[model samples]
Target chain A: MPKTLEIRKLHVEIEGREIIKGVDLTVSTGEIHAIMGPNGSGKSTLSYSILGHPDYAVTQGEVLFDGENVLDMKPDERAAKGLFLAFQYPVEVPGVTLASFLRTAVNSIRKKQARWGGQPLKEISAIEFYKRLEEKMNLLQMDPSFAQRYLNEGFSGGEKKRAEILQMAMLGPSIAILDETDSGLDIDALRIVSDGVNALYGPDVGLLVITHYQRILRYVQPQFVHVLVDGRIALSGGPELAEQLEEHGYDWVKDQLGESAVTRQNG
Target chain B: MANALNFNRREGYLEKYGFHDKNSYVYRTEKGVSSRIVEEISGLKGEPEWMRNFRLRSYGIFEKKSMPGWGADLSGLRFDDLYYYVKPSDKKGRNWDEVPEKVKLTFERLGIPEAERKYLAGVEAQYDSESVYSSLKGIWEKLGVIFCSTDEALKKYPDIVRQYFGTVIPPGDNKFAALNSAVWSGGSFIYVPAGVKVEIPLQAYFRINAESAGQFERTLIIAEPGSFVHYVEGCTAPVYSTNSLHSAVVEIVVKEGARVRYTSIQNWSDNVYNLVTKRAFAYKDATMEWLDGNLGSKVTMKYPSIYLMEKGARGEVLSIAYAGNGQHQDAGGKAVHIAPYTSSRIVSKSISKGTGRSSYRGLVHVRKGAHHVKSKVRCDALLLDDRARSDTYPVMEINEDEVDIGHEATVSKVGDEQLFYLTSRGLTEEEATAVIVSGFIEPIVKQLPMEYAIELNRLIELEMEGSVG
Candidate 1:
């Protein structure tokens, strides 16, 4: 069976205040879905909830990954189960070289995969890991020195975004959530990152691109588009909906949906 | 991930280096300290009259000086209830085969013999308060280098031992120094002739097997002009119901254009009070470096110091301390620049977890008329959890013009975001915490030699095991 992520009636609250209110969605392997929303529309909160971030309390939700409830799992467990989230703002882990961190992360997931049953996975050798890392880094057009630098520390905005993509490529998750990955990229970096994602895209992976604008959609073309408003998806359509929103902005969707659909922060 | 346990203080320390062998002491002194006891210790060594009198005078100093009033709490330390001396064997072994079976096995378990065979130029294995094994490679001996126990030095090279015994750190320096001076035994005594350079490091392994006993080892090293030497020491004690005391004094003299580096990895059992005084005097154009690592002990108050006595001298100290639950690591380094054109640097890193506390207490002094002197001190601390605590107390006494001094301190907690980031990449919380901790101490760990650095990293991983609940 193809891998699937089914989020049903998910109600997430951050510090007792509801952020993602009763959201429902299903994403399957080989599908590309775009979650477009304005600021404070709960786009980030929705992604965090799916990843089981401790601060995002799931008051009522069932995030099932291939028939297994993911809401009860820890973040690492979720990652081990082939769920990867690329943060908008990557954290700086000082003194840990990016190469070592990637190796550790890869080995951790490999161990879990072995326990989860299939072919018994052996940890990747240093030479093999480095060869793959260098290949992926080259595809992303990143400097070779990037592997030796501390993870995300002293990295530029564009470098941090590229690092997120690099990790997504190396982890090879079944379902990858890109949270505002296009926010901090320049025109050149944006194309390189989109190409890198496209290279990793295949029938074995599902892509969930959560963003505020449709700029990345122009390059990576999501087949399904859902406009989230006031912590709910008020509009669901095909790729044309994203183009229409980009041409007229989110105000068009809010006006068409009605006054109730306007963002609470704006109210 | 759900089954991960929280950091247990005693388990980590007890699981590593806490296994003790049956005590096979040939002679052990009665509990507590007295003038008569000091005399008895000196008499047992069959030392010269001057040395015996020196012990007597140091005993008077110890009796007069009170306990230290600052730093880690010592009220629980019962000096009167401690065995001031415990002799493991009557004679020191010149080879591993000559050492007692149990003692040799302990050293073998600690990897002392293998390490010596592979890289070290000399080796000393101190069991309890006596040196059980001492050896120096024939190549170094042919170069007029003397490497032996302090007792053997007192017998063979009495003139050199007497000349530099208490020169750098005297008996009146502190109460612990006074006590160690009065009852010192079983420490390495090294002397390198002028123009000689011992390429490999000399290592000493100290083991405390007797419960509630004191191990006062006096180490003295003298590097003649144009010579170089590096001495490394490691210590561990067995777990006991009552507390043990480890008070040692290490002094060194680096002569003109000479250099000396001393590295100490102190991992005493939590039931031991590790109070040590280490100091070195660097002469013109000489260099002295101290690399100190403290991981275990109930309360440790040690500040390795370097005093630049002439122009062009330099000093450097890199120390790392890890405090687990119910432990207090009060460690740092001191640099006193008393001559022109001298330079010094001190870097300290500390980690505290689960009600553990680590304090960086250091001093950098540039005396008057010591112009063109430079000094820098940096301390960085990482708290593994909310219950852990860290503090920095830096003192800079710059009384000279045209001098440079810099100090930097940072206290950071293992942030939730950092943990979340690593966990999101498939690392468990425990593994993530250990990764961050290893990174935090990378600066100091990188400076250590290969074997020590690997051992330190492994020990840190052991301490970080089950750190997350």
Candidate 2:
């Protein structure tokens, strides 16, 4: 059986206002899907709802991960089921070294896996963990000193993106939703981060890359692209759709959809 | 299921160390204080005529002084309901095996002996009103270091003890200091000779095992010229329905080219009032540091102070406090610069959960003639819930035109974004909160010894459990 993440008729609200209005999507192992949209299109809200953020209320939705209803699970429980979300703007937790944070997250997930009758994930020794971390850092072109710095504290924009990719690579999730991972990166950083994400591609994992630009799609190809307009997917097509949107811009899509696709941005 | 997360189980984490036995003490004094009681205590100890007069004067001051009008609420404190003195054993023991069985069992449960064997150069275990077991390593003794109880030091090294006692912190400085001086009992006395350095830390453990008891331990430390020493003290007590009182006075002297570091961790029961006065006097080219951690108590009001009396002297205070339900930790630091080229730094961190309140009350003073002086003070507080409270009261008095002073403070709540970020990385809410809190205090926690740092982390984790939404 293949691992899958299915979001069915998802409706999310924040503070009594609906943000994600009846969106439907499904991602399976070995597939790459991209949700392309402009600002205020509810792309970030959909990702946050899938990850079970406390601020986002799922009024009517069912997120299934590996055939289990993940909407009823806590964020950590959902994460343990191999569902990862790469935040657009990662938080800065001072005094917690990146190495220590990664070790704790890995051990927590491993502990849950052991409870479900798989191989017991013994605690990783410090030396072994450091060896693995060094290898991942090298692949991402991150300096070794980054491992000892506080998690995302005072990190440059490019370093934060690379650190997120580094975490995704080390965690090896079954399905990952990258929410605007290329938002604040320059050309050099974009290529390094795109390459890091591509290097982690395998048949055992699935990827969902959400973005507003076609710039990163050039380096990391996506098989399918969906244009999210007004809290719904207005159009879905092959990789050529992203190229069309890049040339014509999201205004063309809104014009084509006409009065039915008026986007509303709320604070 | 929101109710499941808000179960209010703060007491379970601390209940393990709150067991008490009612009839364990050998002798107990009547409730309340008077000149007669002070005279009786001094006469019982066979103290010198000067010391006896000093006690009488302190008693008079304690009676005349009024209760403090600021800080934590002391309306519930009933002086007439507390036993002013309680002796748990007949005499101080030279060896652990010679201590009374009941007192020995308490220290065993607290793991004093095991800690002493592993990392300490000397150990003193005090129960109730006096030191029950005291020992110093032979190597430090061979180097002419004096490590003993305050009472023993008064009897054997009277010249040195009399020279430094009450010099740094006078009894009339505060109401609690006067009370502690009048009824002071077993505390550590340390002396490091000139040009000598003691590598390992000397440890002292204080326990209050009797109900409605008052424990007043007076500690004095003298670091001679060109010497260095580090002293650590830890306190705990059993739970009681009625409140107990703990008022200690600690004075330290640092001579020219000398250095001294004093570290204290207080985890009293919920029914104990911890009001302490600690001060140090540093001469020319001397340095002093105080690392204080307050974790448990009903109410605590302590602000460790340092007086720079000569040029090129330095002082530092790094303090942390945690206040849970029905607890108040009003603690901070004070630095007084009286001479030229003196410097100081104060860093305070506090956390409040449930209905607890944590306050930072501090002072930084630079006298008129203190030229080229520098000082910095920083205070940070974290409120875990809406009901929890925190406050910062900082006073800086600089009369010198050439002096530099800087102060910064921040109050922050646990952000939803930070929690979501950590939980999305596979950590439970409790675990995520613990990680954030430990990270918040890591700057000061990292400065502690390895064992103490580990214990502090564990304590924070326990405090974070069942504290999540």
Query: Residue A267 in candidate 2 has what lDDT?
Result: 15
All candidates' chain B TM-scores are: 0.87, 0.87
Off by over 4 Å in 2: A115-121, A258-267, B1-15, B90-136, B205-214, B235-243
* Candidate 1 chain B: worst-modelled 10 consecutive residues by lDDT: B117-126
lDDT of 1 by residue, B1-469 (tens): 3233332447754443333323545787899999999999999879999999989899899989998888999988888898877876532233434434533443343344353421111112433223332334566778988877787789999999999898899999999999999998878889999999998787664222222123898899999999999988873323232338889999999999999999988777788899999999999999999999998889999999999999999999999999989999999999999999999999999999998999999999999989999999999999998999999989999999899899999999999889888999999888899889888988777777887776677667756677666
Clashing pairs in 1: none
Candidate 2 local lDDT, A177-224, one digit each (tens): 899999899999999999888888778888999999999889888898
Give the Å error, residue B162, model 2: 1.3
> How many residue pairs clash in all the candidates, one count each?
0, 0
Instruction: Give the per-residue lDDT of model 1 (tens digit) for A1-267.
Output: 589999999898999999888888999989999999999999999988788788889998689999999988999999999999999999998888999999999998988888888667799999999999999999999989989998999999999999999999999999999999999788999999999999998899999999998999999889899999999888889999999999999988879876554555478
Alpha-carbon runs more than 4 Å astray in model 1: A118-121, A259-267, B1-18, B90-136, B205-214, B235-243
Error of 1 at B463 (Å): 1.2
